[model samples]
Target: MLLSGELGPGDRLPTERELSTRFWMSRNCVREAVRTLSSMGVLESRVGAGTYVTDLQPQVLLDGSSFVLELLRHRNVWEVMETRRVLDALAASKAAGRITAEQLSELRELMATMDSALDLDERIAADLAFHRLIADAGGNQVLAAVLRTVAGGTTAARKRRGLTDAHAMERMHAEHLLIYRALERGDADLAATAAAAHVAGVEAWLLDTDDSPADQ
Candidate 1:
């Protein structure tokens, strides 16, 4: 699409037969790819018409990451969080250059909601949404998708551990605000540093809990 100027939002895709021949892959492989893309909201199928490229909106395509994360087992959650921290740090760096005023406003709104959330579940939801907005602003679709998946897994693990203390919540909110402020100043390096610090705090908290009396 970028190369040939033949692809754009809502453009009808070539038939499976055509794609299979073009890619020199089995028809089954093409079908599977189409199915996965459809799930990711990258492609839409109209029964009577044909499959077509979607709107390419960040939210639509990135929503599939949640489904991917939902399949992770308990033991994988820590690894997922580590991945999230790395991705989020990179996203903060990129977003410092690419983030828009509208994205910033949305992130602040989510932060406000987080401040007012009355329960663990609500706080978790707001926290996830806040990070997701940062990912979307990062200007990298693949990275945003991966962040979403890792974030989903991390949220699930936090819920399971009953780790939603007031102190933890307050700390998370403060860290998020710091990162947002850094991005507002268009400081990629500072934004990355803030993000790294935020996730590292969470990782340390998780580790501390692992060695607490309750765990024993």
Candidate 2:
């Protein structure tokens, strides 16, 4: 029914028994099917209310990958950044080619948060949102999924590093400007280059801050 458009996003699904009756299947089968769809982020169940269809956006569904990210601790930070660099660059390149005006407007709002917000936490939130917006707009769910996982993996490190350095924050705003400008111009190559540079700068910072005894 979902595939046949008998149900649409935000539509509340019938009770398991109702579905079983409608489809001539057992209630257990209906329950299992609902559970599976819920895991896939296609169906959402509310305890008191019942189940409904989800928006099914990739970003909304891919958060489950964060558990896998936790298991990637054995991977080097540079290795992770290397992957993000490539994925983000490609995502940005794609977004530049096809982003809509409404999406641009949203990006500009995030940029404003990064620019004028005095709270470091707010600024960082905007920073992450800006990056995610580009990837989501890229229209490639798989790339967005991988990038979100890689990014979710580093979120703790970013907050721990703090955003206290005034100069660094300024540079961050500038780097975001470069990327957003490229995106506004619909320059895929330039967007890719800027995205790569943004991630590369992050890698450089991580290397410089290496506080292990070997470096000490």
Candidate 3:
């Protein structure tokens, strides 16, 4: 009922007695279900108030999966890149056809920010924003959340373990411009290709060094 939109976020759940009576189940069964939902972050219990649905935002729902993402990145970076290549390409392709003018503007701004970034951290920040905007423009919250999870999971760890410099930032800036231009032209195929190439470059760098994901 909750997922079907019968009950939305912030809606209070029925009392345990009401639920038990409505469902023809015993109070113990209802209690068990409530406990399970709470554990999943789908429901919350107030100190004195009744239970309510959680906010249901992707971040809230995906927070518990961060450790899983960390485990995947630590165990295999190729797997991470493999997953990203598909998702990033799909996001770029969708954004090529669906992106709004405002989204395109934002991406261009991020490109400029990446180009002018004096330090590695600033460049990375802009780079993250660029891809996130593309994901948002793709119009898929679930995919965006998953992408964020993996990106966040590996970004710092990879930087710490792999070698990076100003030259890398410059290269990323140039590559990002190609992606933005593809989207600007509404060329879905071109966008996907550009996105794949950009991701492949990063993978090459990560695999080029002696350090690996597990080392971090």
Report clashes for each candidate as comma-separated counts. Answer: 0, 0, 0
Residue-wise lDDT of candidate 3 within 1-216, one digit each (tens)?
Answer: 686798899999999999999989999999999998887789999999999999888867887888887787778878877788888998899889999999999998888887787676776777788899999898888888888777776576436532454367667767898999999999999999999998888777777667755665
Return the lDDT, model 3, position 100.
Answer: 91
Q: For residues 20-135, write the lDDT of model 1, one tens digit per residue.
A: 99989999999999898887788899999999999887657667667666555354555666787889899999999989999999899889887887787987788888888888
Q: Model 3 — which ten-residue stretch has the worst lDDT?
A: 157-166
* Better by lDDT, candidate 3 or 2: 3
Whole-model lDDT values for every prediction: 0.79, 0.81, 0.83
Tell me model 1's lDDT, rounded to 2 decimals: 0.79
Model 2 spans > 4 angstroms off: 1-57, 73-75, 160-166, 212-216
Kindly provide the TM-score of model 2 when superposed on the true structure, using C-alpha atoms.
Answer: 0.71
By TM-score, the better pick of 1 and 3 is 3
Model 3: lDDT of residue 57: 82
TM-scores of the candidates are: 0.72, 0.71, 0.84
lDDT of 3: 0.83
Q: How accurate locally is residue 71 in candidate 2, as Cα lDDT from 0 to 100? A: 59
Ranking by lDDT: 3, 2, 1
